[model samples]
Target: MRGLGDHLTIGERIAFYRKRRGYTQEVPAGLVGRSTDWLAKAESGRRRPPRVDMLAELARVLRVPLGDLLGQSVLLEDDNQLDDVPAVVMR
Candidate 1:
């Protein structure tokens, strides 16, 4: 079976937020006092979820609500089934 890692691609979502906020990995890394390579890993999902502090800093630097970064909207209302899941989404 595929590992849990294969099923979760928060990196893509993180990349989306990063681009929407007009930041490259380097810029946000500078703001959050982490190395650019570290940021790259996080964006690529090679690293697990960043610390809450880092997430907050990234959200502020990107000019998006923290909830957006955290995906709060989907957390409560949906199963968040992976795209590969056979189930369908319902309203």
Candidate 2:
């Protein structure tokens, strides 16, 4: 079985938490003073890593612990090595 911590790239993780908290891109974008398209780009991995402020706002909206967004978890049984990845981006 795939774990939630495994299958998620940074953008997908953001999108997952956003949806989980009932937030649409437009809504959080407005709250954070960003354009909806920019948020879309972030969520789709088309943009580079979001700025710190954006990440903070996203964390607030998603209600996730900040460490989760920062990818700080490491279960001994998990060998995925997903740690140290702050964000995912399309090149």
Error of 1 at 38 (Å): 0.6
Reference-based TM-score, model 2: 0.69
Number of backbone clashes in candidate 2: 0
* Per-residue accuracy of model 1 over 1-91 as CA lDDT, tens digit each: 1122324344555677777677777887888788988888887867776766667687678766555555543223366432221221222
TM-scores, one per candidate: 0.63, 0.69
Give me the runs in candidate 2 sitting further than 4 Å from their true place.
1-3, 73-91
Model 2: per-residue lDDT, tens digit, 7-60? Answer: 555667778778877888888788778899988998897888576557767777
Off by over 4 Å in 1: 1-9, 74-91
Model 2 Cα RMSD, 1 decimal: 6.5
Q: Highest lDDT: give the candidate number.
A: 2
- Native-to-model Cα distance after best TM-score fit, residue 23 in candidate 2, in Å: 1.8
For model 2, what is the error of residue 75's alpha carbon versus the real structure, in angstroms, after optimal superposition? 15
- How high a TM-score does candidate 1 get? 0.63
